[model samples]
Target: MTTTKRFFRNKRDGKWLGVCAGLADYTGIDVVWWRLGAVLTTIFALGPILPVAYIATGVIADRKPAELYRDNFNPEEERFAMQTRRAPLRSLKDVHGRFRALDRRLSEVERGVTTQNSGLAREIDSL
Candidate 1:
């Protein structure tokens, strides 16, 4: 027996409630196609049923984890997360190096400020 991943609303790709986007992610189909199909179905025979179903599903489904963090979705952050997941230690090391460099720069700025002449003197000199 195989287990399927539970479907969640893909708030990142979705324009509204992300029902079609969620369906697309779950079924491995393009979101545009799902949206087109939904609209056509809603306009043709299904009438209001499809839209109601969509709304209900959107309300009931959980938001995808990627979209849960911020007010708006960011695909770039998701891509970064995936890359970091692939090489967590390397990513951590890179981040640490960047923070260390920033720390060094800040320390230099602090030292310069502490040892430098007064702001009034510098202003007078610049004139």
Candidate 2:
């Protein structure tokens, strides 16, 4: 997974654009839980301050692109991660095994790309 530098309006506790969701994306926390915490924080002890902050955040902070919430998350920070770069594994148990697997896959892809380029070069030479 490529690590895209995401920009989301997280000026406050959030629901849509997954402000909370975007936060979860950046922090590796569960979105549902963060949302709950924000809700609880607002409801229990704070004045209108929390709610007002949420509104302000909505207006100010960047919002995640609606479609990007899916598996392929692309956001703007001018730091778009390469697709081939693997995102940190959610867990090491399954992750350790995949490194070798990924290396093999990348190697194969590299071979194919290199072959195509070389063939193009050869054709140019012939011309």
Candidate 3:
């Protein structure tokens, strides 16, 4: 099954309204980095502007779905999800490349199994 990637507030892991946490999730960055950036920007740079934007984002963004990562907790899956969210076309190309490699490997295995190649059988038996 395929899921459309969208930004969602991660209230479960968030300290505030999950804006920073959502940003972390979306960008594959640590939540601490997002929180620190927000705090630093609020204090040293944008002042009230940053806070206002954060509040607006919290209010506007949808809460993360409970079933979004429900079944498994795989770090690789999370990384892939983040990459897909960040650059979908690049992710598509990566998946296509993986499938192509797998197809090539499978065809080689089929050839080895279907043909009566003594050398290939001896090589398999040695392993």
Residue pairs in collision within model 2: 1-86, 1-87, 9-61, 9-62, 18-21
Best by lDDT: 3
User: For residues 1-127, what per-residue lDDT tens digits would candidate 3 score against the true structure?
Assistant: 2244578898988998999988887776778999999999999999999999999999999998888644666768777876887788999999999999999999999987898988878999999
lDDT of 2 by residue, 1-127 (tens): 4344655753333546346766665665656877887789888978678778766766676766545444544443212222212244434434566787999999999998777587788899999
What ranking emerges by lDDT with the best candidate at the front? 3, 1, 2
Q: What is the C-alpha RMSD of each candidate to the true structure, in Å?
A: 10.1, 10.8, 4.1
- Whole-model lDDT per candidate: 0.76, 0.59, 0.85
Off by over 4 Å in 1: 1-4, 67-127
For each of the candidates, give the backbone clash count: 0, 5, 0
Residue 61, model 3: Cα distance from true site in angstroms: 3.7
